[model samples]
Target: MKIVFYGVITAIALSCNVQAAAIDFSTAWYQVAQKNDALQAKKEEVKYSQALQDAAKSLYLPNVDITGSYTHFDKPISVDTPPVGNFIPSFNVPLTNQNFAHSSLNAVLPVYTGGRITAAQDIRQAQVDEAQSNYNLATRATFTQLVQYYFGVVLAEQVYQVRLDAVDALADHLNHAVKFEQQGQIAKVERLMAQVSLDKAQIEAQKSLRDYEIAKLALTKMLKQQDSVLPTTPLFVNNSVTSVTPYLTKTLTDHPGIAILNAKREQAKGMVDMASAKHLPEVMLYGNYNLYSDDSATGELLPEWMVGVGVRIPIIERSGTSQEVVAAKSSVRQVNLLQMQMQQDLSILVEKTYAEMSQALEEYNSLASSQALSEETVVLRQKAFSQGLSTSLEVADSQLYATSIRVQRLSASYNYVKSLAQLLSVSGDIDHFMDYLQINGIEVK
Candidate 1:
């Protein structure tokens, strides 16, 4: 029985097909719709924000404008004149021109803007950095989804293989049943039972294929690919599992979820700065060069210019900049509170996933041992039946046990790998997944 069990194990190992080219997870991850859109939109937002920052920086630079106007008056103003050479009575005379035109070139350079320019630039800069954090969050979110779907396909493929093995084993049993019936060793009813089991196994294999196809199609859609992908990564548990202490310590600074929130908090703080800037007055230096045609008083064309300083003092702000400052401060407090809640939730999620990972690892290890025993039992029962020392029902029961254990082992393996990956994902350290596998000396094809 032991020899037969070893031979079966060898056969199963030898039957494994050469693995396909592995899908580059990094490449595939970039293709998912949510991540792609978030990344692209963030880039556009950065451009927009940079433009705003540039505009803010230009506040110190001078602004120049050109203006022109024409006017025709029905009655022109009269100029009061005194007698020049003689002691004549003072008189008034209407200006000859009734048409007038003026053109001007004006420029202003801000000396100060109540610190609004600086605050606005700071706000825009913070927003750009915040956009980058948002992109990182999107990446991590999409990666988490990929981990599930990616492993799902692998599990479905394993199930399909199990079903195929069961069907093949049942077909061989049906052949043996026919031979025994013809030789008068087994009843015709026994042969009918073998045929029935084979039919059921075939149906189950077909169903397993359907499930595999569905998983494959779902993965294809996520990748935005024209063809289905075959995952080359094997499912296996890390025997050298480590503690989650480092992850929790780093979560606040490194976790993409937390990073996004922190960035928002900084932006809100800048909002307070922007709102408070309105309390101070604005000052600017301005110059205007003017040309006039046919002035009513002088009846002469001339050009004139003025350069001066301007100030807009704030006396009463009816819109209440104070309220805006208060609101901005409240937003900071609210985001900080949300950040606290998220921290708590993340810690809980890590602990729960770690616990699940440990359980899956235990189940996986236990099943590995149970599978060998189940295979040995099936072989011994089959050998007994071949020697006429056991009934067909006894051999069939052994085969059923073997098949059940095989499926369970597959499930355990998948669960262990999936949970371990999930733990890293939630901790915002999925990049360390390969390191975890390496620690356990597991190789992925």
Candidate 2:
């Protein structure tokens, strides 16, 4: 029976190892970039902005229209002339017919609009800029999320391995206790205590397995993969200390959020220009050609074709163009203030994340000696128990202590990795994260 149980366990482990597909961080990010809906939406927004820009540019083109109309009068009007009674008779001259039909083709080309068109084009360009920045921001955000999920799986797997080791160690101790009690060398209570500790370890191992499965599921779903994913990148930490100054400077200069705000401010300025243009005159070149005329008089009165330059000066507007200008200026000020606040908030966030990364690294380093010591103690206690020099409880306690240290160290590494991702994301330097990983990352053993 014991052989059958051990065989089943080995088979299950082998199957799991075969089924999970190991992927590196870069490949995982590429998969996510291709599959993530939110990132695709942002890309579409950029295209939409580009279309708007084209539309704005089209405003410079002339507008052509064809119009036709028919009209009926109450009566035909004419003129009568009376001549000398004796010499000639009176005659009537026709002026117009009772019905008239006419058609015209017209074109209007803007010569100048007091900068209204220019302002509109500028605003549209700013919108394009803002859309591009937003897309970049979305990309960075997705990358950061991927980092968390990928490392989460690694950490869970490591923890589960530690739990399995603890279970194996306690099981050996329990077997020894059972044998000593049966040989009349130890009390039966000692055997029972060992059984309890082994049961507890088994329960913990089961919990860790559940956690590992959950983490794997999350990563698989993120990459839109049907098969289970195993992260090739381990949880890591850099022992070297990094300064926050460079991160802060880079964040202030290159952050997408800052770029978005700058775009908005420019858009607001464009609005102000557009509003002020309302108080100025517009110049246009207009032409009309008579396409058709049923009546000869109408054709003679309306010229065959006419062209003229037209000017429209705004004398009065009920909507108050001045108030519009004021509102637009106020918007510019508002955007400026928002930009300042965003910079401040981003700086603070960078500092906080940097500090957390440093702390996790320090904690991980500090636990190294403790982990070694605990591991050595576990081996010593197990040997002493086998020689009848130490109790089973002491061996179980040492095993549990070693397991706790391993879990804590793994947790610290995970924290460091997560914080580093966040710091890079906020600083607009997430693109360099893989470089850092390659240069500084020390994989947890």
| Every model's TM-score | 0.85, 0.93
Question: Mind giving the per-residue lDDT tens digits that candidate 2 earns over 1-445?
Answer: 2234334444554565577899999899989999899999999999999999999998989999999988888987677879868798788867678887889999999999999999999999999999999999999999899998999999988898888778777877887898899899888988988988878877787777778888989999999988898889777787764699988999999999999999999999999999999999999999999898876565568889999999999999998899999999999999999999998999889999999999999999999999999999998998888888898889888999999999999999999989999898888777677776678668796
lDDT of 1 by residue, 1-445 (tens): 2234335533543343233235745456646744456567866776877787777777678999998877777866678888777768779887645776767899999898876777777777777677766666666667777867877888787777777677667667777878889999978887787777766666666676777778877887777666567776666667787787876776655776777677778778878887887888889999988754455544353447889999998888898899999999999999999999999998888888778888877876787678888889878877776677777777676777777887777777767777777777667777777666556545422
Best by TM-score: 2
Predicted structure with the largest lDDT when compared to the true one: 2
Each candidate: RMSD:
5.3, 2.3
